[model samples]
Target: MDLESHRFISYFLPDQRPELCHSATIEKFPPGTVIFEENEKPDALYLVLDGKIEFSKRGGLGQYQNVAWAEENDFFGEFGVLDGQPRSARAVTCTSATIAKIPRDRLMDILERSPGKVVLQLFHHIIHYLRLTTEQYVNQMVHKHKMMAVGEMANTIIHDLKSPFTGISLANSMLKDLHQDEETQEWCNLIQAQITQMVVMTEEILEFTRGKATLNQKTFNLGESLEKFQRLNFIYWNQHNINFILRCDNIILNGDENKLMRVWQNLVGNAVEALDEQGGQIVLIAAKLGQDALIKISDSGPGIPEAIQSRLFDPFVTYGKRGGTGLGTAIALSIVEAHGGDITFESQAGKGTTFYIRLPLC
Candidate 1:
């Protein structure tokens, strides 16, 4: 079979396929080559004869967010071809690739002559991939929150044992004071040793399980903190089209860096997911306000849906995106409160959203 027979162009009627096939010029590009930039006018629609093409966007401060990928036998730039609009996402070669570039005019001409089958074929592939990604995302979220539940339960068990154990130790001390005979003192000592062993064993178990063990607070520069955050997330950003822009005053903060990092991540991650297909921006800002450090995370996507606004911090609340147990925001709120901070947000439908956080700088 000919090369065109293996691609999306094959969906066209047999008689009309020849013209479209003839218009395509096969070309080879090395890995990491940029095929097109987002918002650039389309020159051609490309088909992957071999290798892979990543769809991503480079945004403010040169942050790159990957949106999707097209592998062997797949076609890209369909939106530009169908509507003659600027490209929505930038395309780059992920590996050495042999690609067939079909001029836009020829592709559009064939579509004009036979639009029915080809148009449906294009949209069907689009919807199918989205459905698969979404299902996988929801499943992963469910599993994550369930594990978090186990962690929280384990922490609660540890906390409850402390008070009763302290009471038992105090009572044991009184018995020792009341006893004067050697035999009575020996029995008291045995009970004390057993209690010490119990406390040691309980601590070891908690150390073994190690779920958020305790908040390790330290002083850190807020600007430096966010820069590290952005660098660490390059791989995660490779799956969505969202840019993170940070503005900070180099304010010093005393808190659990890891936990605070989780707070920012949860908020920014939700922004990226909410902007799926639409693409948007995330702005992170930090500054000292009085004795408190003010942190603001903003997103340019559609604002939070009104239905879930009131209970957004409630244990299982979620909105506008995939369905999942909504423990993320609640956990974020809990962490901030634990550090004596406050969290709140303001959102307007279609205008986007911004979340505010305040924590003691000292």
Candidate 2:
């Protein structure tokens, strides 16, 4: 082999036998060729002699994202070889490339024969790679935790500020109605309603942040509560041109009325927002399924993307034009879990989505 093509030998001891290097072979690949794929065995070490290689993985929703790249003289597959594990990523050639392949057995033989220099070099490389990987992981975790803490703090501050805001907005609406003409009063009413809605939304978010929102264990008529929730929010839904459908016989569930009210509110509110100005249908159904009470909510708006459906209940994951705070479903999940119930959903892009809630009956 040419001295330049045998550059990997520099990592070995000066007195090491040259037989190991002589056993290696140089191979060439064309652009778009897959050098290795994730989960494949790493039986040989590949040292790039020329051109570029891209490392990527299949992400959520079956998408591929390039996470790293390698260039001339860079070594690939070393990490898999040292750890005795399958390949962690897929590598593809970005351009026509030349690579030197060293068989694992031959490499091990050279390392065993030249203990000091080979061990020292291997140790240095392994330690450096591990340190970098650990740092990257830690940084990501820290950033996530920080964002959660900030969201919690904001929820608390907003809660405290909303009470006075609600009172002021209400009083302003009354005052404007008494002192202004019909047109001005109408605009004032719109502003007041918006402020009040904001106040209610803030309180709901605060309840979610505290992680204490749950149905109170009390015997309440599920049918009646559903009716009240619909009646209260009917104007809002109607104004948005969202058709609401309720199909449930008088069924009773032992739960908190206020907390369950919030659950329906959030789910229905989400459905309404998803409908956009194009108009869509929201269906709410309650039925007896085995020994549990089943509540199903479905909507006709564009459905949740597959990329985010798995993480939909996770805090800070949102979809739609409203750019949600990502707490609604998280709070809904927490509340349902607290009630000894469970929630699930099925969705397809451009079609629609449906959420199912199952709770044990008292």
Q: What does candidate 1's lDDT look like per residue over 285-352, in tens digits?
A: 99999999999999998889898999898766787668645756876787788789989999999989
lDDT (tens digit, per residue) of candidate 2 on 1-362: 34344445677765553675576788899999999898898888888888899887777888766666767867778877767799988999999988888888777766667767677876787677567656655665664575567558767768687778877887886889587788777667656655645655555566665555534489988888788667667778879898899988668888866666667877877777778878889999999888899999999989988898888998777787576667778777877888889999988877888999998887
Which has the greatest TM-score?
Answer: 2
> Which stretches in model 2 have alpha-carbon errors above 4 Å?
1-204, 207-215
In model 1, which runs have C-alpha deviations exceeding 4 angstroms? Answer: 1-213
**What TM-score does candidate 1 reach?**
0.43
Count clashing pairs, candidate 2.
Answer: 1
In candidate 1, how many Å is residue 279 off? 1.4
Task: Please list the C-alpha lDDT of all candidates, in the order they appear.
Answer: 0.77, 0.77
